[model samples]
Target: MGKATGFMDFKRQKGKEQPPLQRLKDFGEYTSRLEDEELSKQGARCMDCGTPFCHMGIEIRGMAAGCPIQNVIPEWNDLVYKGQWKEALQRLQMTNNFPEFTGRVCPAPCEGSCTLAISDPAVAIKSIERSIIDKGFENGWITARIPKTRSNYRVAVVGSGPAGLAAADQLNQQGHRVTVLERADRAGGLLMYGIPNMKLDKYIVKRRVDLLAEEGITFLLNTEVGKDITHAQLKETYDAIILCVGSTVQRVLHMEGSDAQGVIPAMDYLNGTTQSLLDGVTAPINTKNKHIIVIGGGDTGADCVATALRQGAKSVHQFGKHPALPKKRAADQPWPADPQVYKLDYAYEEAAAKFGSDPREYCIQTTKIVASSNGKLKELHTIQMDKITNDEGYIYFEEVPGTEKVWPVDFVFVAIGFDGVEQSIGEHFGVKVLNNRLYATMKNYETNTAGVFAAGDARRGQSLIVWAIREGREVAAQVHGFLEEKNIKALA
Candidate 1:
């Protein structure tokens, strides 16, 4: 620990963000960076517990408990507290290949598992991490670590999201020639389109992409394998292929009038908006002057609400099938587990500031969508649901009688979570899908097909960016081992 009584001495400080109204005017990062002194003070709060559960990346009951990348949180925090920023950056990058991305967007499970968080606030790990990396970039300490020699092994990584990018970075460092193929016109997958620029600027994504290019990783944008390039060709050209294609298929509500013209998937809506902004064209899915309804209350749903509000929507409402969580951790949920507590996200705050009320409506189910004469969605018929548990460990919800209501809406965004990977990509590689409707994975993320593997949302279903990066690094290690074993066999 930096200071014996640091946790007691200093209060938890978070990064400041621009006012919601001002930030909505343009597409740029809103979070302001903490000053050097402030960051050091925050770093001093790290207790450096005896067990240090913050770095223990374990899964309990199917949920991640700590930092998935296993970042040396305390080590880096101590380094930062001592004013050794250069050393701190190096320590931060030892496990996380892309702290820049995770620092800004990751929910920071490390903080949740921090020992101090049992009673007091957790260490400002995420902010310290962001500061360390930003300092590295500003000081020119961050640079491409190009391989000195080539292994003469070629690897193909499909999808240029965090998982694919991490895999390519590791493979390139191991002296193997790595190529990334992205279906979109640009790389960064969800980073490029799914998330709004205000949260994670596209330029930041491009900055990292450019650095990877300099490190000898080949990025083939708009060249989708199995479509533009055949599976046979990929197998013949590369020694191994890693599929990082994320879960792009969005789930839908099979309610009445679901096929209306105004109904669209959340990814489609976000993609259209980002692409239009990138191309300097009028947004294709404009919510301007429209009453919008977003069905789902996850991050994607919040994103939809924020995007609509930014596009000058007359009004926006977000509906969630599940009831709202408690403001504090529930009695059953103890420390070291990610608590299901209610916290206002950026998008929700923006909506509330502008509209004078939170846009979210919890425990409401959409029974039917009402469409106008043109077959466009105009309103949503919904009913309140009561949660109840029955025998045999089954959970069910019942619609409350006489609680039906119609919400006026001109545009409807289905923000329900993804079902699984797109069928075309998986079918092309002959990947086996399990009962969960997600890609089947072995210990190292390898699929049934030889010389082929998978990772990220493609393998584990839709998840956090931190999980994607963890899988990416794990798959890279597996690929390296496979290649090494093959080389040894050839020599024998």
Candidate 2:
């Protein structure tokens, strides 16, 4: 431990964010990094518990707790506390291949499971992690470690998102010839488009992609297997293939007037906006002077609201099917578990500051969308709901009586969530899918088809970037083992 009483002496300090009013004006990163000394103090707050549940990654009450990739949180916390940033970065990378992405985007289950959070505030593990990586980049310590020799075995990774990138990186390190095929014009699938540039800059994504390319991994942008090239052709050309194409099909609200012209999917809106911004062209779906309604209360919905506000929307409103959670942890939730509590994310705070109230409407359901003569959406008709338990041990929602209301809206973004991988890709490859519509996988992420594997959102459905990276790394190990065994058998 860096300091015996460090946890007691230092209180947790969160990363600062730009003023809400100022940040709403553009699509730039709002969160500010802490100074080296301040970050060290935050890291010192880690108690480094005997059990260290921060890295256990257990499921509590059906929700994930701690780091999913089993990150060595305590070890790196101590290294940072001692001002050994280079060492801290190395320890952080031991388990997590991409700390920079997770540090910026992850919900930080490690902090939620921190022993210190039982009573006092939790250690700022996420901020400390970001600091370590930022220092590594500034010092030019992060460089490509190209392999000295080649295994001569070829592997094809379909998708260039976090999972696909991690898989390619691991396979390249193992001396295998790896190539990532992306259907999008640019590499870094979701990272390149789905995510707004404010939360995660596209340049940061490009920086990592460039590093991976330098390490001898080939990235084939705009080349899609099962479409541009047949799946059979890929199977014949490469010894192994890993499918990391994330869940892209958006779930829709089957309500009246859902097919209105102004109604659009959240991913489509965010992707379109980011692409336009990156290309220095005007966004096709401009929200200028429009009253926007975003359906859903998750991160994606919040992102849509933020994006709209930045695009000069006159007003915005968000709806959630579930009721707002309590400000503090509930009775059933305890320490070492991610609490179901209310907190204002950057987007929500910005909305509150601008609208003079929280823009979220909880326990509400949109029954129908009203459109104008031009077939453009004009307003949303919604009703409040209440949660109730049924006799069959099931939960249900009942619409509250006399709570119907109509809100003026010019644009509507459905941020309900994703269904699964696009059906076309799975059908073309003939991979078996579970009842939930996700890839059916067995040991080591291998599908029913031999030498064919799956990972990330495609295999496990829509999930965090951290989970995707873990799946990618695990699948790469499986692919490497399979290739090595084949080589040995052929030699014999």
Candidate 3:
């Protein structure tokens, strides 16, 4: 859709970021967008291949291969390249409900599977996307389009995360009276709390929530569904109930002295910091001048490292059970698959700039925690391990013989990931749950309850925000069809 040979003419360029050490002083977003000229060049790099897999939205070897929402990526890239920004925004919104959110936080599986990535660097699709939306906002071209007609249906959406917000937006646009229920004090569930402000500012979330409200969606905040109201009550009020309660059950460390006072869950640490920032109060847990250890080697672990660095941590280390990833795609991860490659993440860069070395300790496993005589955190005992692959294609960890070590640590943050959706929410709604996920068939998203449905992480287990958005859109269509077939009408 762009120039025929633009990929060859223009090399890939990326957005700018604040210097790592300098940005460590505050929690503001360090990244800045590229100017229009550069962004246009980036867009021009879209080769518009005959078989574009950038928007295929499929999975290979259990890894996302493209845009999960099936974004019309090449079309928007061409629009941006042609300087038709408003049209680009239109194309982006056609598939994605919240481009701003995904642009800021998504891993951009689309880029990973870009045809150009098979040879040269992929087009800067994520940066182009963020610029398009940001420009739309800056030009005041984006506004609320309140539905002109109101329907006789009411939809009560539980949870205000990405999935719930997407469903509410779709249903409200269809003229259904939609209400979003959030247990948190604010609307944007994980966006508002689970994520740190440095990555996604709370103002951005509030701005969108305000826009949604203008479009006739009601947000009931600081209200838990089971504790504040009953399922029967919701069914009596709304024509259909859609559960988007995200998978929030965090996993914890289980070992000797694992319950030490200074150990904390990764989400708790992130949420506390964000809430305190918004409320203008002290964070509940302080890391200033304290030696910190974070368990788990995922994005959450990196976030913990960054948070600790900003909070004036004396020293920081991240422990991961897995070995370091290869610099290039391995044999198992072929073309179009999201390659598990190694790169210095922002947190690692900042830590290295300040501490003179990377903070990650790969192939390490924590065995136990040692508490002081006063029952405070004292030391952490760990051992290094080697990765072993058996003939049956099974992988396992075998401990090294002489790598046992101990370090004096003051705090520990567990970032290993989540268990699943909170079971209590499902039990309250009378929905059957298996493997800690709400049991909804892929065919229709309908639960055992007649008028109730489930989607997003609650139904699919832990997943990316894009997947959640896709499910939200799909479930809204399903709910609309079900209501039409039943001929359900609001009673006066």
Candidate 4:
């Protein structure tokens, strides 16, 4: 609203990324922040629409259509346009505890729902948010503030990913004694290891974790809730327990030769490589001069392909079981929703630049993994899947008779998503595990066990980081209220 014709005058643009070829040489952040003036112009494209759907956060077609964190989008955009970065940061944080994290890895559903996107490209919300936070850091605006009052109510959080971090931060801010227990050697379960350093640097995660610690949120690393310390001990030690233990069990491809020597789960591969990077050593799953195949088509699978390329894989093939998306959004998938349009991820870009061909192969089904005589991975047998509509008008994939092919393979990374919350966690905590393999939490995020609650992927199954943070904040508010109502009857 600062400039009446701002949206008409300004164009949409995002920050620049390091060239695919040059960036593939190492694991580091690829995108660079724009200059303040350039970023302000990008912010000017918000237009101050009377009905801002950017922060509405409604779900369309079962997927999020806007910002899940309900970020005060237009307000901050106006602040950024006015060159008041500190005020913008304050507005951004009013609703979001960590705009910095969402600014980096989120898919930016907000952009999808932007009114401007219905006509032209959406406002540069992600880059603008990033610029504001980075400016806050540069000006020493972000700092740990000790709570003015201490309720002394002890709370134990059973993960340090986004959800656990958010819940812990909120509960600690309300003067509760918060302790986050992470089974990993470090905090940030998925953000630390599941995502590659190139997408989200571990130092950024560590910086926030360190800040939380400085603000008196104690983090117990390398401590497994069920193993190192029993569930009963944790319950006795803390007044409440919030289970943010994410859906960790990776889905397995139970195919022929699945037990081959070189096949590995996506998390195991991703986590090991990241830990090695942190330790200043070469990654263990060295792909130099090796043919790599990444199974599954989700972001994690895409990440596997990108990681292999960076590690000098001889060749890479990223396969998706389903058919390729349309170049343009389909009729059924219209504007304002997150349409599945055909797009190349950074991995495909790197592979195309390095090998002169895109790495992604669609409609692929791995029927078997051929093993060598020494019980190692030698080749992978695959079949092309064709979509067939049955007489009843139902569509499903069918194997084209005689379309089987075998290709030499050295490593296979299964990134087919998660099975559920780890069974051991539910069992140890004595929480009800639904048939769907996720924890059974009440509407308010409480499990059957008193003083025990679940949030994030543990309760909702595999979901976005923004959703996880929302769950974390909402659950913390509920838990704090529950603590206050010592003698009140709980809602059914």
Candidate 5:
């Protein structure tokens, strides 16, 4: 503990955010960092529990309890409080490979699991984390770490997302030559396109990618493994291969008029917007002067709402099948478990500011899509739902009687979720797709094919960026071990 009574003395404080309406005018980061003195006080608030559940990195009741990458929270907090930012950054990098990305986008389950959160507000761990990394970069403390030695082993990493990048970083540090193959023109799969620029700037993603390249990790852009090259070629060329392709197949919303012209997937909308932004062109799917309807609820749905607001949508509404989360943590979500509490996310805040109210409609289910005579999406038909519990304790949603209503909508962005990795990639790599994810042994991250491994969303299903980074690090260790064992056998 930096100070024995620091937690009692200082209240948790967060960084300031740009006013919603003002921030919506441009695609830039909205949050501003606290000053050094305030940040030190925030760090001093760390109680530094003996158990330190903040970094246990475990799951409780199917929900994350703490930091998935197991960031050393207390030690870094102490270092930050003592004005040792360089030391804090070093402690942070001991586990997390990309704090910049996670600090911005991650939901911060670690804060929910903080020991201090049991009573008072949780430590502003996320803000402090972002500050440490940003300061490190500002001070030129963060740079490429080139390995002193080199191994003859060469590894090919598919997909340039968080997982693939982390795997490449780790493998390269182990003296292995690693090549990251990305289908997109730019690296950082989800970070580059799936997420909007306002949340995480492209410049931040590019800066890290450039640093990795400087450290000798080769990034092959616009070259897909199964298309530009074949699996057979990869097998012949690299000593080992790792698949980190993310879960990208969007879940379909089957309904009447599903083929309507204006119905699009959430990723499609986000990707198109980001690509056009980077290419200096107009996005094909513009929400300007349109009544936008976002189907489903979660971070993606929230993001869609925010994007539509920025695009000058005339009106916006988001639909969710689930009821609103309680303002306080429920009994089911106890201490040490990430609580499902209600609060306005960044998007909701923006929507409320622009539209006079929050645009989210919970406990509502879309039943059908109504199209015009020209087959263009005209409106959406939805019904209110009530939560029902059966005799066996199974829960389901039942449509409320006489609750059907029509919503005027110019476009519908389906943000339900993703199924898994694209099937063609799995088939080409000869990896079995079970439950919409690549079949890989959890113990070793090895797929059925020899010298081929899988990790990240492709193997674990859709998940957080922090989890993806953790899987990437673990898979690299396994790959290094497998290569070393093979080398010894060959010598024998």
Candidate 6:
């Protein structure tokens, strides 16, 4: 929109990342922030279509295809191109409350659905976004704006993750006395633990949390809603409550030797490592000089591979049941649709650099984890698999004949998936759980009980942090409306 020929003049250039060999040594951010001139050129690559799908928030081919928060991609793109960074940051904040989080961790679906991506490479939207916010930080444009008036509403947000933080930020801005409760020793939930430090620096998370506190949003750490503090006490204290407790229960493998002392959940390993780093103590679980095996080839598994390398793992291998992906997008995956394409992420890149081979092993299934004489994970029995979708469309992986193999290992991380939201929340709050899933939110994020609502992974199950932020903002609006309606009813 800034220049009619901007898309033609500028070629897509991704933000530069440190070489894996060097970056794996430390937990600092690897991506180098682009200079202003280069970022302006990147922003010029936006086509800014009349029906831009980048921010449409549509589901394509059964997968998310655009910015889940529906960010105004083109407006910010134009602003960045015109060197209006302050205005760009303002426009970005219009929809996304935390562009900084998504800028680093989100798998930019917006670029995948970009109009320019139909043929040419998509605009560097993610890089531009990060640049905008990073510039705002450097220029001191990002600061706390405390509300002048109070709505006289008191709200308690459970979970200090993306959803809880977003809800608390918006509610506090709307003149509500909002308090965020985090069970962890510190706030920021998964952002502070589940994710690795290199990808999302804890300083960034802490900075935002600190700003939120300055804006009058109270954060109470080391106090879980249903545990240390009673639910009845919260009901008596706050006028409204919103649950943002994410899907915390990690899915476990039921194979033999799965309970080996050295075998642990992915979240546990990740969380402990982060907590140890924050506390300036040794990690409870370490992969240094250990042959580590991570099960499940999802983002969590990839993160394990990267983290293990940083921890000085002797060797790392990640196994998955799914087959290797096709090199190009398949026919079913049309334009504007998110396709499950073959791509190497940061961990895989680091793994290949350190181990001289990719850590991800597809179409391989581990049948059992075996313990050694010392009662630690020693080896894993695995086999090759061929997947088949039956008449009912349930995927049944068929084991290849005589393909059993075993590999030596010291530590095993079960990164398969999450079960659902933690159940203790239901017992504590008397909230109704949804059928088929453990989610507990009703329409407009309202729970069955009055004056209570749920958002993020707790309401929608395990999803992207971007989606969590979106749900948090929406839930905040709903909370505001509910409170205003209540006040009107009392006046009447």
Best by lDDT: 5
Compared to the true structure, candidate 2 yields what TM-score? 0.98
* Model 1, span 1-492: residue lDDT tens: 779788999999988889988877877788967888888889999998899989898876665688988999999999998999999988999999989898999988888889999898899999899889988999999988889999989999999999999999999999999999998998999988988888888988999999999999999988978879988999999989999999888898797899998999998999899999889999988888999999988999898988898889999999998888998878766778777789888998999889988999988989999898988888889999998888887889999999999889888999989888878777888989887667897897789988899999988889999999999999999999999998999999
Q: How well does candidate 3 score on lDDT at residue 262?
A: 92
Off by over 4 Å in 2: 390-393
* Per-residue lDDT over 330-426 for candidate 5, one digit per residue giving the tens place of the 0 to 100 score: 9998889999999999999998888888899989988889899999999898999999889999999998989999999999999999888888998
> Cα lDDT for residue 276, model 5?
94
With candidate 4 superimposed using the best TM-score fit, by how many Å does residue 311's alpha carbon deviate from the native? 0.8
Q: Candidate 4 on 253-359: residue-level lDDT in tens?
A: 89889999999998888898999999988778888899999999889988988888888899899889888889776787676777777878787888899999888
TM-score of each: 0.98, 0.98, 0.98, 0.97, 0.99, 0.98
- Candidate 3 runs further than 4 Å off: 436-438, 488-492
Q: What lDDT score is found at residue 157 in candidate 5? A: 98
Off by over 4 Å in 6: 390-394
Which residue pairs show collisions in model 5? none
| Model 5 weakest 10-residue run by lDDT | 433-442
Global lDDT for candidate 5? Answer: 0.92
Local distance difference test, each candidate: 0.90, 0.90, 0.91, 0.88, 0.92, 0.89
> What is the overall TM-score of model 5 with all chains considered together?
0.99
Clashes of each: 0, 0, 0, 0, 0, 0
CA lDDT, candidate 4, residue 193:
88
Give the per-residue lDDT digits (tens) of candidate 6, residues 143-236. 8899999987799999999999999999999999999999888889999999999999999999999999999999899997777898889999
Candidate achieving the largest TM-score:
5
RMSD of every prediction: 1.2, 1.1, 1.6, 2.0, 1.0, 1.3
For residue 72, what is the lDDT in candidate 4? 89
